[model samples]
Target: MGLIISIIIGLIAGAVAHRVLNSRGGFLGNLVVGLIGALIGGKLAEMFRLQVTGGILDQLVLATVGAILFLFLWRKIRN
Candidate 1:
């Protein structure tokens, strides 16, 4: 289902972002972050009129970028 696919995408993207950012929070937190990032990324893409025909790969890229941005903002806000 679509829901399952989205969760899988989010989890993978979150785990990668976690390692890349070297930030705190465990797997579950990361998963939550990732799902949020996917939503953010979708909005951003829509705003910019950017469309990717490449399915999950494109979703992963956008979600990862969004996750990193979200984490960066979170750090700044926390600090």
Candidate 2:
């Protein structure tokens, strides 16, 4: 159940990030980005001591922001 939820969040977050950044990574790529972003987002939230409400919407926002950051950094490094 937890894994399923994570996957759904990841897909949504990744899609949102891709849309915001105007990137064309496909479904699997977005999933990968989103999953990794979740990890990064979790760590960042911890580091910053951000308040989390334990809601799906909060998780989605965090994951989407992290995915955008990840994509931005990835592009910088790639270029």
Candidate 3:
């Protein structure tokens, strides 16, 4: 149940991040990015011992941060 919620939040966050980052991609692309972002964010949060309350907003915040970071690195690598 938590995982499902997290994934849903990740999808929304990824889509929004794609737009904010001016990323050109389709729905699946956005979903993939967002899912990866969620993993990345979750790992970082764990490492830092950041206590996320396991809610939609928390998931979105974490996913957005991760997505932004991913996009930044992606652009750098592409360039």
Candidate 4:
């Protein structure tokens, strides 16, 4: 259940990040990036003491943060 929810959130977050960053990728690629982003973002928030959880909106926000950060880093590395 949690995994399923995370996947959905990741998908949405990835899509949002792609638009924000003007990045390109297919659905599967986005999902992978999104899942990775969620992990990264979760850890980052943890270090910063951000209490995120308990709601879809909270999860989405966390995932989005992760996705954006991941995309930014990837872009920097690629360039």
Best by lDDT: 2
Which ranges in model 4 have alpha carbons more than 4 Å from their true place? none
TM-scores for the candidates: 0.90, 0.95, 0.83, 0.90
Q: Model 2, stretches more than 4 Å misplaced? A: none
Candidate 3 Cα lDDT to native = 0.83
How well does candidate 4 match the true structure, expressed as C-alpha RMSD? 1.1
lDDT of 2 by residue, 1-79 (tens): 9899999999999999999999998889889999988888988999999999878988888899899999999999999
Give each prediction's root-mean-square deviation over alpha carbons. Answer: 1.3, 0.7, 1.7, 1.1
lDDT of each: 0.85, 0.91, 0.83, 0.87
- Which clashing pairs does model 3 show? none
lDDT of 3 by residue, 1-79 (tens): 9777766776787888789888886777778888888888899899999989977788888888888788778889999
How does model 4 score by TM-score?
A: 0.90
Q: Which clashing pairs does model 4 show?
A: none
Candidate 1 residue pairs in clash (backbone atoms < 3 Å) = none
- RMSD of model 1, in Å? 1.3
Model 4, residue 23: C-alpha shift (Å): 1.2
Off by over 4 Å in 1: none
Poorest stretch of ten by lDDT in candidate 2: 53-62
lDDT of 1 by residue, 1-79 (tens): 9889889888887887788899776779878989988988888898999977759999999898888888888889999
